[model samples]
Target: MQLTDRQNNIIAIVKNNEPISSQNIAKELGLSRTAIRSDLSLLTMLELLDAKPKVGYYLKKGKKLTNIDDLLEKPVSEFMSSPVSVEENQSIYDTTIKLFMEDVGTVFVTDTEEELTGIISRKDLLKMSIGHGNLKKTPVSLAMTRMPNIISVKKNEKFIDVLEKIVDNEIDSLPVIDNKKIVGRVSKTILLQTIMNIAKKF
Candidate 1:
């Protein structure tokens, strides 16, 4: 739902000048009607705008803007992303590589049974590296924040509840658990993006 800058501009133009033609909107933005054809179509599809046969485009009435409180009450399962995990016995060096390759702030640690056991963060790896110890020989379990100590969430948990935990714990991400197994991860970045997407509708 994140709109491009041009899309936002188009919405603004259409809002201020109701029943405005696509040709005029494009001219106002110094573009061609063909160039904004897709933008108009998308805005209409999102119900932010509406069109008529002979008329042009106008802001859609009667549709309520997104309510942030209601949005946060939705389940985390709807927004969680696939988790990036490493085995507990994985070497610190290899696990660090996995973190970089995954481009994630934290990595979940799993046992031989593939159940969640612990969690590791980029900060944890960096702290271990300062010792100048042999990372290849050191196991990731040595640096992980073990279960019962790790902050986590369930898939059905409310988004607002997860947001509260993240803010209270000062953590970057939480592993989504189901029957003790990691199913997904909800991160600060994802939460912020979701909120921004809703905010743009206003």
Candidate 2:
């Protein structure tokens, strides 16, 4: 089920054992009945557990993962990393070196005002250096995937929704923008790893 952390813990306590009273659960969790009442009610409503008069609670047959949200609607901010960046005026030679040094596949490009203007991938740099032959003479801007064409996400965007954008755009990563500037980034690597962990539990 798409449960919050506290709700999941409540389920675990009930699952690992059985026929536990709400009073016992609250005491075990160091919470008051008043604190966990809503979670208990919701779990009972979902039929994940059964309650009987004076008997408290017992585990119902699990229909788990059938209701579990794969992504749990987590915000992209939780997975964001600092984006490796380059100036719009920097040479492709410098940009290429920074790309390797930062160990990121893409470099977000910004102007003198620190406003995002473009983005460059290793493929973009490789194509320019190999095809044009003069890396030092060409600004990164000359080969960059320019702004207004960049598909970006916000800090609060859900991970699953952003995953769709990444696959649809065929991109390895996207810059996280806020207030018209880059804040952080999220990538396919982290997305895949996170979901793989969830799948394992399922």
TM-score of candidate 1 against the unseen true structure: 0.69
Q: What digit string (tens of lDDT, one per residue) describes model 1 on residues 34-124?
A: 9999989988888888999779899888764565877778898999999999998899999999999999999999999989999999999
Clashes of each: 0, 0
lDDT of each: 0.92, 0.86
Model 2 gets an lDDT of 0.86
C-alpha lDDT (0 to 100) for residue 52 of candidate 1: 91
The TM-score obtained by model 2 is 0.68
For model 1, where is the 10-residue window of minimal lDDT? 62-71
Task: Tell me which residue pairs clash in candidate 2.
Answer: none
Question: Candidates' TM-scores?
Answer: 0.69, 0.68
Candidate 2 least-lDDT 10 residues: 63-72
Estimate candidate 1's RMSD in Å: 10.0
